[model samples]
Target: MKLRLGAGGTLRYGAGGTTDLDLPGDLTGQVVTVDLRHVDPGSDAGATALLSELIARGAARLVISGTDTASARALLASAQHDAPPSGLAA
Candidate 1:
């Protein structure tokens, strides 16, 4: 499946653990928000893992512009925990 992470971030995920994040894609400056707070328990782990990887690779950043505070908090929390490397800079 393909998912667009607002503001130029994009990701592709498929079976067998194959995935890609960022990859020079464009978000078209559309400020869409994702409700991460209520992500089902089953998918939370995967979301966290994917966000961690995106941060690690400098492919994503935290931005707030939605009505869902809980979701923003969850995403921010994940970013903080992972803490992408400064030098990696994508």
Candidate 2:
């Protein structure tokens, strides 16, 4: 089975074709972990939106785990570019 972040940041899970899975509404002060095992590398649009929402909603921490750590980290990093300004720039 493969898990991927589909369009609009919807989580898709299953083998062959994927199906949308409902994500939690609020992530405030929560530690959310996203599994990216067996997922293909592609556009990070959905991931970016998800990361934005997680940050906007005050998620305590995000743990990305999977066989494809590099791709997962890259995906998260891409989302950082679209994140809201936090005045952390140099």
In terms of lDDT, the best-performing candidate is 2
Backbone clashes per model, in order?
0, 0
- TM-score of every candidate: 0.41, 0.55
Write down the lDDT of every candidate, Cα atoms only.
Answer: 0.45, 0.59
Best by TM-score: 2
Over the stretch 1-90, how does candidate 1's per-residue lDDT look in tens digits?
A: 233332223334333323564433333222323333334444444555555554554544434433266755786687658755545534
Alpha-carbon runs more than 4 Å astray in model 2: 1-26, 85-90
lDDT tens digits, residues 8-66, model 2? 44587555436775655555667766555434556455666766666555666776666
lDDT for 16 (candidate 2): 40
Clashes of 2: 0
